[model samples]
Target chain A: MKILLIEDELELATSVLDFLKSEHYLVELASDFPTAYEKAIVYEYDCLIVDINLPGGGTGLDVIRALKKLHPESAVIIISARNGVEDRIVGLDLGADDYLTKPFHLSELNARLKALLRRRHFGGSSDIVFHEIKIKPAERNVYIKENLLDLTPKEYDLLLYFLSNQHHVLRRESIAEHLLGDDADQMDDFNFIYSHIKNLRKKLIDRGCLDYVKAVYGIGYKFTDKK
Target chain B: MKLLHQTQRLFFRGVLPVFIAAGIVSFFTLRWVFDHETDEKLLGVQAEIESYVRINDTLPTFFQTVFDRWYAEPMPTGSMTNLKAYTFSDTMLFNKFENEIEPFRQLRFPVKMRGQIWMVSALTSTVEHHDLVLILAVLLVTMFGLLLLVMLWVNRIVSRQVWQPFFETLEKMRRFRLADHALLTLPPSSVEEIQELNTTLENLAYQVRQDYQTVKKFTENASHELQTPLAIIQGKVEILLQNDTLSETQAQQINIIGQSTRRMVRLNQSLLLLSKIENNQFLERKPVALKPLLEKRLVWLEDFIAEKKLELETILVEISLEINPFLAETLMTNLLTNAVKHNIQGGFLRVILNENYLIVENSAALPEASVKDLTARFARGNPHSEGVGLGLAMVVEICEQQGFGLEISFEQGIWRVQLRFRK
Candidate 1:
């Protein structure tokens, strides 16, 4: 899935970018008003993450407005440190799907992303049942044969993204960009993605559930129904 | 209840009764003196009549007794001439003594009996004419003078004594301050009414100031406490968003967290500002040039105007105002920002300044609401705008504090906000 991130901070943006690449989402980044404004108009994205205050010229609010005009079907989440009631109201009124204030936990972000994706793609259903394991979107739940699979917020989002593209190989850049946006570049390494995936797989197996997440050697991971 | 009414009520209540008592006492005393003067006059007349009776009875039976009989008759009712005819009768004095005693011709009522009647009447008129009239005049004058002296003397003494407790309490009340809830030191008074009045006033004033202080403290504490949590959340969002490798989906989720934190901060700031305005923190003031100051604001807002695609124009350049510079700047910024921020793209912003008035007119497509409500807190006429809605409210408060008059009007897609200053 192609996603656009509109953020102004450099270090934060690079870190986010690195994390999303490991999760196999195609992400594009714009650090200021003009760049973000141009990128939003030119690209097609399944989801967008935008900040309200941009450095160069316009605001993140302006970017949301432009995005809605260009691609009405695109889902958007507004991020801001403004902490003003009027700012939130203005962002939502411009057709943003959700709003978040700063200093949030990554796990919570991941959980919210999965919820939004399920609602947008599947019209809010309970389970996306693969041949081996059933992925429940409504409950942030996974199950293999009657036993429940425990997944952290990030692990759950990663599993859902892979399930939606079963049997399809996703690139490393695509995963990191999709999950972390412009923030992916800040991490010293992308090893956190391995731990998130590793833990998700371990939890399923430990619960006597089949591991459906498959590594593609040099590329990324994929969920195969034939396995 | 009020100063004037209390004065009048006490005048009638305490002073009026004392005045009435004085009047009654003097009335009875003056009546006694009047009766004594009448007794003295009656006694003097009786002594003279007795001497005349003794002189007549010893002289001779016929002549003398007849003269005595004449003197005893009540003086004739009409005039002195009729009474003289009886006193000068010829048959009473052997028929020939009538001409010899023409001296009895002037005998009068309120008779004096030491000399010839005619001679006594002439002498009385020359020495003390209308003696009875003189005595009555003297008595009336003295009685009225005594009444005035008594009224003034009583009012002075009784008013001072009766009002002493009140004046003392008032003096203490004047020294009372709200810095501390000090207990009043009331002088002991036997007057129950005055004691009650002092107690009630002291309690009322103390309670009102206490409530005011409590409300102020609550607002201060609430504003301080909210800032801590807001700062924590904002900081955490900044830290998390610094991490890499978030899917396009993960980054978007963090964005929502940041926006909520910002909203909280703005609410806290606005609340604090409102409290400061209420507490009269902007009391210190100085003269400010309004027109140039407004222009300076436009310079700061130039970038915003360009981004919003608004056109600006100014009609007048110089007008003086008296206000705190900080408050004045804040007020102008809020007004100017609202005009441009809420205006339609490519809308015109016009500012007009005169000696005592300022008007800002901008092109707007505001939702249907009364112009009066635009200055209310949290009243967002346009839901799409990203404003905290405290801008115009702050402007209204500053205008009131600085003693400026505000007027708002809308017509033909143009909105006008006018502020009038004292000359």
Candidate 2:
């Protein structure tokens, strides 16, 4: 998906740019207020990542408000070091689809961006039809031959990770680390991972879906299509 | 700080004194007028009686002549002493004379002639004169009542009218919140002092609002400008990390960039949050159920509670108060976070909730310092402490904005933060 990230912090902007580019998103960056404002008005983006503090003539909030007025179809996400609930609320009030505070990991931003994209553009339907099973990103809706199945947000994220990384042996530690982010290291156990996998497996089985989420046991869970 | 409050105080301070002084002066003046009028009337009566005595043999002869002339009959000899002995009659002279000297009660004259005392009393003493005196007393009382009413009414009207512009200036100042337009529009008044006051307050409010706006804009611009370069530098480091030729030392450099970037991000966040609070952007308020929300937050912090090895105590009562829910939550969170964040490993968290008040007390490892600066942004006891200092400041802002009262006290090394809701 095409996205524009308007931020004044060079390092943060570049880091975000690199991450999105690596993720194969068509990403464009603007380091100052006027440049970003000019670019936003000129080009139509699927989504916009804006920072509240902007350089040059205009504010990030102003940009959001102006852009939303111009392009109502495009989803907007506010990324700011302003962790004040007031700022978040104001951004939200100004038609931002989501707000992410600074000091956030790229993965978390990506997750939030993906969530917003799905909600704004894809009607929040994260269902990927792969032969016999359909996977929904949000609502954790899983369907096999037209039968619906329930999955939690985390469980759904985990399944999507597996699907994206099919044919690869996902390490348990890496999976846990990625799933919980910085908070994973504080925990003494990863048993919750196994329990989630088991539940997903059972739910799929009960729904009469094929066994694709294979466990590496000591390592991680993987999704493989052997048809 | 509000204009209304300031004016009310000023009314007590400035204009109130003037009214009180005026009232004291008027009171003395009224007493003097009454005394002078009474003295003049008494002297006049004494002069007229002395002249009548000089003109006639005695009061009895004078009274008897008047009786004969007015009623065409010789009065009984002792009837003059018993002035009230006459029967009832309807006449205008009696009414006019009664009205004129009605207040004079006992100014009778006793004459000595041929070694016999002729005790001559007023013919109208028990009837006409008594009634006249009663009417005069009533007239005096009525005059006094009218004077008092006029004085009070005039006092109220004058005080109110004179202070009208003052109150208007106060109202304009009151409506000046940080979020709204700060340009003050003071009402014009005829009084020089009041006009001067309005102009001065108008200027002050305008200056304050202007300064606030400038600072707000600066904060917004500064943070925005800083983010881009920081983002770019971080991005470049990541790009370098993707190179296979990078050594451990180089990787460490990238890691440093990452850490500092994180810190910058946090610092920027705190700055922005503080600015927002100062700007009063989050002022939307509504009634929120306090008990359930507090319970839920405490439940979420159960993990942190477990890690700290602190004992949790709750004494929440069901109460609902009007406030911004988010700010209320932030206020509670900051209190809890500070309590937990600063506490000793095996310390205790004591939470007490009563009607219109909530108190959170916790034990800390660091010795208690004066918590007077608790509500100031970045005013932590320890500079290196993890807290951003905006927590309590935000709490204070929310409390002020929502009309809630906040009190902070340290007792026996226990830092106590109390939130008192306006009853």
DockQ, all candidates in order: 0.04, 0.12
Q: iRMS for model 1? A: 14.2
Count of clashing residue pairs in every prediction: 71, 33
Which lDDT value does model 1 have at B197? 86
- Indicate which candidate wins on TM-score: 2
Q: Which parts of model 2 have CA positions greater than 4 angstroms off?
A: A1-14, A21-104, A112-227, B1-194, B233-250
Docking category for candidate 2?
incorrect
lDDT of 2 at A65: 79
lDDT of 2 by residue, B1-423 (tens): 954456456544665466556555655565556545544443454455446655663442334332222112233355445453122322223335335422222323443333344433332223433344456555655665566557656656777777777777777777777666546778788899988888888788778878878989898779756755555554464455544465657656665675466456555655665566666666787888888877876764555676678999999898887777776776776678678777777889999988869999998865434576666766777776644566677777777777788888777768888888882
**Sequence-dependent TM-score of model 1:** 0.39
Q: Please, what is the TM-score per model?
A: 0.39, 0.52
